[model samples]
Target: MRVGNWIKLSHLSAGFIAVLVGYTSSVAIIFQAAHAAGATDAELNSWMWALGIGMGISCIGLSLRYRSPVLTAWSTPGAALLATSLSGLTMEQATGVFLFSSLLITLSGVTGWFQNLMQHMPRHIAGAMLAGILLRFSMDLFLAMQTQWLLAGLMFLTFLLARIWLPRYTVPLALVAGIACAASLGLIQADGLAWFPATPRFMKPEFSWSALVGVGVPLFIVTMTSQNVPGLAVLRANGYQIPATPLISWTGALGVVLAPFGGFAFNLAAITAAICMSPDADPDPRQRYKASIWAGVFYLLTGIFGATVVGLFAAFPVELIAAIAGIALLGTLGNSLALALSDEHGREAALVTFVCTASGMSLLGIGSAFWGLVFGMSVHLMLRRSIR
Candidate 1:
């Protein structure tokens, strides 16, 4: 198909918003992670470069191959883990940990172990898990209104009106409204913004037993449970049945190649992926892959101009980003809840999943998503036997 035939204004907007939201959300944690390992300014830029390039290639390649919106992101939880754990380790040893964790991910994907495990997850459970994961972002819409009442309120009103009249462009219209309000109120800060291209700085890996055991093992666990699990659930909840094996395999492979350049871990994205898969991206689900493709294009630009892109995103007000992300994901959050509660047999279990996931509970370094699934599935099985 011709590019003009598949791409639309809505697709471009969705793509841009996905990249914007991804970067603005947890980028600070990434900086902390870099600093924890004693990285210099050049090495920090290389980290962003490697992660952007890795996510860009994987998203574009996988989405085109499957004709679905396949979004990838750096491991936020992994970065958080490193931020606290990497203080004692050298950058070289940290690189070794990244490589080790990535190898485990690659083995899981190549052996089809992770995909097979996810296949056993029920549809309702998956929907509930997805809804739970996105609940915070959706709620941030109103929370943002509290701080930047005028800006967020105008964006919310615009979204509602656009949804009725311009269904496909609701998100973009809301975003524009928010930006205009922010600009008028002097919320947008453009100071210190300049074009700075990123250059890759490679570090040699030096393996150690302590780093591998303490950091590598935990990184792999969180990347799988906290990141990849909900990411796959987002795809499945939205009725995209693309195989998980290739998605996992390719991301893992890219992580291995880019780890030396400060790409700690790569995994499928949940929140940003939902933006690309939402109906507002395209009325036709089949063509929604174009959103992810455009996101990949933006990701490439972000990598090429790492510092510039970082400063650009930093210029937007936090409230604007929160409101826009919430408005864009409203449809997806609603659909996930509907699917989760549609079946009377699974309604209670699904609700359990949603509640647990939304609680944001974390234990033993594993996120609430995994625990929610486990608890929900257990309740489901027990309820089934009792009914029988």
Candidate 2:
């Protein structure tokens, strides 16, 4: 097929929105994580470069290979873990911890243990978990309206109208509306934007049992459970049958190679992947990979100009990002809910998972997604006999 035949305005919009939401949401945590490691300014830029390049390559290559929308992201939860846990460790030791965690992730994939575990995951449970994971973003749409009513409200109204009149372009149109409203309201700020390319800085690794056990192990666990699990669920929930093994293995491998340059962790993306997988990205699911390809292109651009891109994204008001992200995800959120509740037998268990995950409760440094699945599966198994 010709490139023009597959590419659409909606795909580009979805790609841009996915990157925008991914960066704006958790980038501050990355900064905090860097600070915890006592990283210099240049090292922080290198971290962004490594993460951006890793994600870009993974996303583009995997999507093309699998003919599916495969998105990857830096491990936000892992960054959060590092932010608090990296205090005593020097930068070299921290790099070692990252490598150790990534090695574990690679092993999990290479051994097929992670794939086997996910292969048995019930569809309803996966759908519920995905819905639970995205609940916060959708809720933020209305929340943004409370703070910037005119801006967010206009974007939402545009979304509703576009869905009725031009269904495929709904998200793109809503995003444009948000940007226009923000600009009119004097909310767009680009006062001190700098344009500089990012350069990678590699640090030598220094391993220790304490750092590995305390930091590395937890990062591996969190990245796998919190990020990759939900990411696979997002794919399965959206009807993609791409195998998990390669996806996990490739991300882990990339993480290991890039760790010295501040690529702390790389895993499948949950929320952003949904944006690419949704119908709003492309009416035909087979062509949705184009959306992710565009996302990868944007990721490359972000990596090439790391600090500049961050500042550019910062220029947009928070309400605009929140509104557009929520609007774009509306279709995905609705569909996930439908799938989660479609089966009468698993409805209760799925509902349990949805609520638990949506509650956003984390325990023992692990995220709610893991706990939610545990509670959901337990309820599912217990109720299985009764439903029969």
Candidate 3:
């Protein structure tokens, strides 16, 4: 495909929103995790570099190869786990743990364990989990309205108007309207903006059983359950039929390669990927891969800029970010909820999944998304048995 033919404004908007939401949502957790591991400013920059570049490379390569919107992301839940569990470990030890966890992930993919698990996942249940995961952002839109009413209201109204008038241009219009509104309100800050380029700094790994079992194992589990599973669910729910094993394997392998440079963990993205996969991204599903490619280009720039990207994103007001995310994902959220409740037999179980996952409750160091799936599937099985 010619570059000129493939590129579209809608595709570019999808990619921009994916990066914006991805960065604003959970980047603080990544910062916290780095701090816990005693990472210096340079090391933190390295982490961003590794993650952004890894995602960029994987996303571009996979999407081009498969002609599908295959986006990769750093594991947010894993980073959250690391923030709490990595207090005692040196940066070197933390790097070692990342390597260990990635090895396990690679092994799972290579052996087809991850792919098999995804294959058995029922569609309604997957849709419910996705809806649950995204509920917080949707809620954020309203919560921002409480504090920044004008900003939120305008963005929301813009989204509504665009949906009615332009249809395919809804998210882009909303995003532009929100930013313009924020600028008018003087909500964008320039306090931390700088021109420092990102440089990768490598730390030598120091392996230990304690670090391996405590940090590495939990990271692997969380990344698999909370990140990769939901990611695949988002893809499948959105009508993509891409293979799972290769995606998982490549993510893990890339994670291993970049671990020494402070890349903690990598997996498929759920929420941001949904943006690229949604109808609002592009009316034609065949052209959605262009959005993924654009996202990769943005990721590559973000990686090259590293810490500067964080500050630049931070400059955008929280309300604007939340509003844009909620608006961008509205179409996706609606579709997920609709599909999740479409099957009469699965409706109740899907509802349970949606409620639990949306509750954001974490137990036994695992996120609500995982528990929701388990509970929903159990209920689904019980209902089938009762009917029999």
Candidate 4:
């Protein structure tokens, strides 16, 4: 490859770490959710297959077609929702709920109603909502240092040096250094490496009314209201000019078809997806779509090596993962915080938004993500007629 092309490939390679971090740091809840729903090992692997393929197709196809950094991810909070709500559900019943909710998502996307509502929302409130969502995860980075100082410190330094010196591959390079330190110190084990390809398992869907009520409806609501809305906001906030409705439709439709086989849910990614979309990763915004493509490729590779890599990531102490993810998000959180505080007229309302979201309250079984949006929007409308 030529020098420029090699640079492109390396940039693409950096995106793999983003995919890995996104999956490992918080997404493990999905597996637990599957287990809670009575999924077997085969069923779990099937879920990985479905989610990987669904995300890969959406990330690759949509990004290429639109020439923007459109990425899809399994909803983390939705997975968390499943982990709690799927406790007594059967696999087939969970699948039924997945399908039902996916249809609702697709309909919402097709109607374009959600986008309209979000568009009318104040920019400050939107920024506040974004900050609130990322606040805990970002704060955890330094907090992680409190527990695993040696591991997190080295990774932190590696990231700092890379950012100051290399500038292009800070997070990925930091991961390399962190892993080396972790392995040598016996803090993490990557001893026996198996690279067997994962086989896809097919699940035949069966519906149950109780599972649909308990699992499906909430999953759909959380994924759409929390994940998809915020993911699109990340794009729009950064001035990515893509049609939200189409992307939403694509994500929902993919989930519907893939859910029965273990694809629990799919939506736009906000935190990790921002990494692929940002100018920091790639200088030219037009070329940033390649990052999402790279993320998709890595997502496929992850599914291929499914359990082995998952073990590798898991071997690293929780604080190590927490520190890495937290530090990685610091820049994003700072920017979001700044945006939240920027609007003078909206500052008070934004504070209300931030406070409500930061409080992390959930009403009607929905998570804080949805409530943050609601409270923030409510405060904004009451504080100023401009939002109303």
What TM-score does candidate 3 get on C-alpha atoms? 0.68
| lDDT per residue (tens digit) for residues 175-262 in model 3 | 6787788889888898768988799998999998777875686577668866888899888887888888888899999999999998
Q: What is the lDDT of candidate 1?
A: 0.83
For model 1, how does the per-residue alpha-carbon lDDT over 1-388 read when each residue is reduced to its tens digit?
6768756899999999898767755675577678889988778889888988888898899998999999999987677557656876899999999999999899889998776655676768877876776677678889998998999999999989987998656776787788788889998899888897989889999998867875787577668866898899999999999887888888999999999998899999998899999988999999899999999999988888876665665688888877876776577678778989998999999999989877866655445666777799999999999999
- State every prediction's TM-score relative to the real structure: 0.66, 0.66, 0.68, 0.70
Give per-residue CA lDDT, model 2, range 1-388, as digits (tens).
Answer: 7878657899898888888768755675577678889988788888888988988898899999999999999987677567656876799999999999999899999998676654677878877876776677678889998999999899889889987998656766777788788888899998988899999998999998777876787577667766898899899999999888888899999989999999999999998889899898998999999999999999998898887765665688887876776776576679778989999989999999889877766556444666677899899999997768
The residue ranges of model 3 lying beyond 4 angstroms of the native Cα positions read 1-47, 60-105, 165-169, 199-245, 259-297
Alpha carbon lDDT of each predicted model: 0.83, 0.82, 0.81, 0.72
Clashes per model (N, Cα, C within 3 A):
0, 0, 0, 0
Model 1 — which ten-residue stretch has the worst lDDT? Answer: 361-370
In candidate 2, residue 200 scores what lDDT? 92
**Residue 157 error, candidate 3, Å:** 1.7
| Pairs clashing within candidate 1 | none
Tens digit per residue, CA lDDT, model 4, 1-388: 4657424764585467568667754554565577778887667777777777788888888888987888789887666556656665667777887888788788889997666655776667766755665676667777877877778888889888987898656766767777787777788756654666666776777777656654566566557666887888899987897887888888889988987787778899887788887775688888888888888887887767665654555567676666666666566567767878899878887777677666666555444545666667776777677655
- Highest TM-score model number: 4
Model 1 misplaced stretches (Cα beyond 4 Å): 1-47, 59-105, 199-247, 259-297, 364-366
lDDT of 4 at 194: 62
Model 4 clashing residue pairs (backbone): none
